[model samples]
Every structure is written in C-alpha cells, then in structure tokens.
Target: MGLKSFLSRPLAAYVAHQYQKWALHPEAAQQRVLQELLRLGPATAFGRDHDLAAARTAPDFQQRVPVRDYEALSPYIERIKQGERDVLWPGQPLYLAKTSGTTSGAKYIPITKDSIGNHINGAKDALLHYVHRTGKPQFLDGKLIFLSGSPELEQVAGIHTGRLSGIANHHVPGYLRRNQLPSYQTNVIDDWEQKLDHIVDETLGQPMTLISGIPPWVQMYFDRLTERTGRPVGEVFPQFQLFVYGGVNFEPYRRKLLDSIGRPVDTLELFPASEGFFAFQDEPGNPGLLLLADAGIYYEFIPAERFFEPNPPRLTLAEVELDRNYALVVSSNAGLWGYSVGDTVRFVSLRPHRVLVTGRIKHFLSAFGEHVIGEEVEQTLREALQQFPEAEVVEFTVAPRVSDTATEPSRHEWLVEFARPPHNAAAFAAALDAGLRRRNVYYDDLLRGNILAPLQLTPLPAGAFQRYMKSQGKLGGQNKVPRLSNDRVLADGLLRA
Candidate 1:
C-alpha cells in the first residue's frame, strides 16, 4: 500500500490519540481502556463468545478470566490442526506463523488480517518514534538487510503456511520497502554451512546500511565476511549504520559484534514473536523499550512470582507499577486472549511507558531454588570479564545438572569457551564462582555448602560457537544460539569436544 494510504487510516489516528492520552493521564487511560474493552464486546466478539458472556454475567469480569499460556491454547491449535478454520476466529485466518516450540515441536500460530495490520502499525509507530527521537529517518533510508528465516511457504493442507517475517516484509509500505535484500529461502531445513556460504556471497559487496537479525547469526555472517575479505566487517561494509536484533539476549554478543564492526553502530532491540509484534527500542541510547499500546492489542503483566501460580493478578498497562519485573501477557486482535508470551520485563518509567526486558520466565536455573535468570547470569559474566580484560568468553551456557557425587544431588555447571589459554584457569573459575555468589545469595549459599560446584571452564577450540551454529543448521540469517539449557542434553550434544 501507498505510504499515504497506510498512514491516513482512522485506526492510525485513533492509535496516536490513545497513545498520547495513555502517556499523559494513565488513570483516565485505564478507565477509557476498560470502557473500550466492554464496548468491543470483550467476550462476545473475536471468537471469545464464551469468555465475553461469562465476563458480562460475572460479578468481577477481570478476576474471573485468569491469564492463559500457549499450552492453554492447545485445544484451539488442535482444531486448526484438524482443519477447522473457525476455531480460533470467527472466520478463516489469513496466515499462520510457524515457530519452534519448547516441547510441542512446531507450533502454527494463527494471525488474522486485523492482527497483521496491528503488527504493521506497531512497526510503523516504532519507526516514526525513532525518526522523531534521532531526527535521522534518512539514516535508515539506505539499503536495509534483514537477516531473517527462510521465506518459503510450507505446503500444509488446511493450515496457513507462510513465514511471518516474509508476510510482514511483503506488506510494508512500498516507499520504505524499496531497499531490501533477498531473504534466505533456498531450503527451509538445510545445514548452516551451505546457508552461510550463500548469505556471505550475497552480502559481500552490497551497500548494506542496516543489519537486522539474531546476534548469533549476525556474528556468524561477520566472521565469514572477515575470513573471505581478510578484513573486519567495518572495512567491508562502510555504509553500515544500524544493527537491529531480537528473539534472544544481545548483551553477551554485543562486545564481540561491536569490535568486529570496529565502530559503535546504532543498535535496536525488538521484542517480537510469532503471536504478534510486542515492543521495540524506540530511542537510541535509552535502555527502556516502548510498548505499542495502541496496536489493537491489550497488555497484561503478571508478577514474576505468579508465573506458575494457579491464579495470578493480571495488571493492565495502567495498573502496572514502575521498576518492577513482570511476566508479559498479551490479548491481541489475533484471537489470543490474555495469553502469556513467556517473556519477563520491567518498566523503567511510566510517563512514556518505557520497559527493560528482564528474561524469559521459564529460561532460568533454579537448582538451588534461587530462580537465576539469563540476565543475571550475563550480568555476572560481564562483571567477571570486566576484571579480567584479557579474558574473552566466546560462548557459554548454564545448566543445573546432577552432580558427580550422588549425595550432592544437583549443581549449576557453566560450560565456557575462551579465546586463548587463561593464565590461571582455577583462578578464573573462582572469580566466576565468586561473581555469581555475590550477585545472588542463593548461589553463595550453594557454593559454601558445596550444593553448587565450582565454575567449570571448558577451553573450546577457536570458532567453536561458530562450529556449533553450523552444526545446528543455523549459521546464517536469524537463528540464535541457545543461551540457557535447563539440562545437560543440549550442552553435552551441542558443545561436545
């Protein structure tokens, strides 16, 4: 669609107005949102007839309808799997985004036209806000390289089959869509070695102004680029301006990528999922992520402690407190009602509704019942790295595995990769152990009682993480290396020497 057509809709104006109102007077915004929810037939419309009816008749509508997770939507997914179109929505879905599930193998997430529009608008809002903040929209007007998944549509009967990234790419404004690269679409399930070769050849001499993708994939591309050209990526892609990434944490890989590029390029973090586009890094140099509150989706934040609770308090965006971590729950126009996206975040402030992503509620190490998250582990590692400037941890994963001694039960083990041989491996391990202990009291206690073993450093050969990515069929495009493993299965198999 034309830029004017895309921007001139009443929904766009309404979203802008609501955003302003919510930013300024949050209390009034809450009441207005409640009214809007009621007016929209919260339970009746959008395939939520049962929920709407129950909410309307219940004494406390909000309290009665508890928050739900993807598992809770299994029945709906089963219906779709059984070739039922109207199970999720009142009509046939336009597309289904296929994503890897932690346990369910592959999940086909439904998306309606309105939901597609919502995602597009949310992305547009992020771009507009970034332009307003940096006054450099033209910086992004150059060739934008999106490191994405395969664009091929899987042929599945009675199921929407296209990749979500490909669908969104096709639907962007024509003007802003001109300077884009060809996506990786040869084989959806090929090994990373062949894919990496193809991606490197395609991007070598291109005037790439922006690089966007998962950190691990981006690093792989740069590594291959450096090897082929015998120079760092900065010398190769001089026009590169921004590096946008998401789907996983960026902190661990940030230093390496920046060093490889040989300069401080603009980096943008986006919190998007197969379900819908959730949030994006709006302003440069700001740690807080802005929420797309008006993207035709309502947000709910359940306290981190309530993640596994039978019933958790669902706090609306207005009721959510600042500076506290919360598990994100979303109800989008895509027919997902009060669905938990399995992500945890904390609000940095409320005036503009800025937030910081804490971690995934499930991706944590709780062997000693400390509930250590990915962020905590990264932070501790960063602190340790700071003290030993020469030390470089190329790849690492933390897991709670059974201890060697039966009586000890379980302990947190860190599989670490280094650039070179450390002067003192034992000392380095001690430092890391101390860092973790100091960061969290539970780890400290575990260490004293020998519940958690000393930090183990596995001196992987150079290019190990790269090799691991290559083995996983994820060397190129938007795949990220798994950061945390709850058990030794992946760690042993993937990181085996």
Candidate 2:
C-alpha cells in the first residue's frame, strides 16, 4: 500500500473506535450534550429571553422553550443579520447557512464555531467507518469530487453567508485539499448547467476515486461523463470506490445511478441539514443511519400525529420508541432552542439510536385524510421497480388530483420520469397502488370505501423534473422536488410544463 492508504487504515480504525463509544452509550452521550448546551445557553439573548439558564434538566428546558420552526425564530435571526452579537448563541456565528424557506423565502441558519465540529466530524467519521469496516482506504489516494454549491461567499452582517455546502468549502481540511476535485473557478459558476459542464471538463482526465453529493446532481454528473466519454462511469474512473449521498432517499434513484456507474459501489447515506449534521450510515448493508448523540445537539421527538397539537409531548433519547414517525426537534450549541428542522424520522434501531429520515413534516399528502408520506411513496416505488427490473426511475413526485366536477372521483397522480420506461406500465402502476394499500391502512380503506380511485401514473418526458426545477431556479445544490404534496399546484405546473 502507498503512504496515504497505509496511514489512513490506522486513522480510520482509531476514529471508528472513538465513535463507537458514543454510539454504544447514546443516552449518556445525549445527557452530556444537553448539559453542555444548557451551560452555554445563558450567554445569548435568546437564552436570557427563554430563561434557558433556569432550566436544570431536559423537562425544565422543554417547559421553558417551545418547539419552533424557522419563521418563529426569524426575529432573532434578523437581529443577528443586522450585526447584533450574542442574539442567538455566543457573540457572532462563524457563518450563516442560507437555505430556501417556505414562508420566509430564505432562511439563514447559524453555524457557530462550537457547532461546526459536528458538521465536519460527522462526514469524516462516516468515511472512517467505511474504511475501518471494509479495510479499503485507497480511495483517499485519488481525486475526491464533491459536487457542491459554489465556494464563493457573500457577507451578511460581517458573517460569511452561503449554502451550507458552500460554507463547508472554506473548511475543507488541508490534508484533503490536494485530493479535492473540480477547480474553484468551476465551482464559482452561478448556473448549475454551466458549472456541471466546467466540472466535467476539469475532471474528465483526472483520477477520481470518491464522488459525493445529493443523488440527483451526482447522477447528472455521471450522465454527462458517460455521454462525453462514451463509456460507463466505472470504465472512465476505475478507482471510483465510494458513493456518499444525502438529502433524498437513495432507493428511488438506485437503479438509474447504478446503471450509470455500470458497477456496484459501496455507498454511505448521511442525515445532514442546514441545522446540523445529525447522523450517518455506519455499517454496510444497514438502512439505518447511526445518530450523532454527542454532536453538541440535544435532540427531541414529537409524534408526527401530535406535532401540531397545542402542547405536543416531547420525547428524548431515553423515551423514544422504535418504528414510530416523529418530528425531529433539536436544541443545538449553535443557538437554536427546541427548533424543529421540519424533517420527520422513524427510529429503526434504538440501541445505538439509528434512524431513517422518513420525510418532511409539511411535505405529506393528507388531502383526503390518507396522509401518505415520502417514505411510503419512495418505498412503494422501490418495491414496484424490483418486480419490473427493466424499469429505471429517473425522478418522480405525487400530488392529489381532485376533479372540479362532483361526478368524477379523486385520486393520487404520480408524475414519473423514467430513464428506461417499464414494459408493462399498467402492471407497474397496479403494483405501486397495491404496495401503498399494504403500507397505509387509511389509503387501503379509502380505496375500499370508493372514496378514492387507484393512483394514476403520468409518464413525464425525460428531463421533465430537471426542466421544472430549472424553471423554478432550483436546479442544483441540495434542492429537491417534494415526493408528494397535498395539492395540485406542483402537478398542474408540471403537466403544463
């Protein structure tokens, strides 16, 4: 083995050993994290206003601070944006992770010096887990391509402001800087299409080993590489060993992505967001991601059904159960107190606190009280795709199709874009409908009661989703189309497009 791999093997082993301590004793780790957050809470304005200093225990903290979304916390965020110090966390944050918001248009999430370690270390530990488990660390020797937002930053009240990925770019460790791919000039291009082309040109001849990004964008990169080289991704970059992805479920895009790669590759899934780096897949063949209990974030969960209630019951690590959907809440060292990041999760394993990100809390279909989630749709599609091995899904979304007239029955409409359309589309649709019924009793009851018709599949033109996203100016860098919606706004817009 060469110098890098030889050194990485021991390092990976050491990191994995250190990580397992917290994974094994998650509740203890969480208690410690909570105490640390509580200790730091008194230095900020939000801390003073919420009486965080008076909170001695989890219940005390919960009682003092109510769960809040971005809009609810924007007043303090605005104060920070206007150059105020110690508004949320201590003094000023190192950077602001700007994300697209629903009602607020744009959200600026604080990333303090205290909390940045969670983001960086979570990613490092995930890779280390893979290296230690498989004894394969040669990927570190070649160029690592991270398809991300531009590294360029704009100052917001003396703080560097950009997408979370962009903010992270400034912090890439010096050791790995030599291996990082896609030149800074290429990354700075504003238009995604243009940046992608420049990236392809720059890395076309390089020895790329690791590729990481949101699934869709990485797939796009793979497609461009294959189109240009007239060879599969594996043939083009034989050293490419790892696929690191997050932001969307990989199951839905697995077939197409694998086809593009032209071979099997080890994959790692992360549960990261603007708010914090929450979890990462630590074991091969495991669907669950191990939660970072000691990541300077105190986590809470409210049952998804009772999330909007006047006073939802908040459960901590010790109180949560397996397989129940819960809206994820956190009070991080970054100054967020009892903040709901809008994502819902289901615990698959409680021993090490492993979880699967089920869906967004607001991004569900409850138009007819069926209440289908992103996990259900993605899972149903994944199962349906299995029976029809020939079909390769590119992208898809679902929305309620309610008729204007009373005579017609309402049904769910699935807008799918396929790389390889199924041979028998009707049979595939039937399989998906059956799977949904099997998964959700409410949906099954609606079907049996004749209140809803079987779902309708609309085969969208290839690249239709991309075109739609492009039109919305959300073409790249962590933006994803919702899996399902309660209304026809997205479906109508898609059909019209």
Off by over 4 Å in 1: 1-22, 25-51, 54-60, 155-157, 183-191, 364-497
Model 1 per-residue lDDT tens digits across residues 350-408: 87787887877877665333446566678778887887787887788787664432244
TM-score for each candidate, following the candidate numbering: 0.68, 0.76
**Candidate 2 Cα errors over 4 Å, as ranges:** 364-497
Deviation from truth (RMSD, Å), model 2: 14.0
* RMSD in angstroms between candidate 1 and the native structure over all alpha carbons: 14.2
lDDT values, one for every candidate: 0.66, 0.85
lDDT of 2 by residue, 177-202 (tens): 88898888888886666777899998
Could you tell me how far off, in angstroms, the CA of residue 72 lies in candidate 2 after the best superposition?
0.5
Please state the error at residue 127 of candidate 1 in Å: 2.8
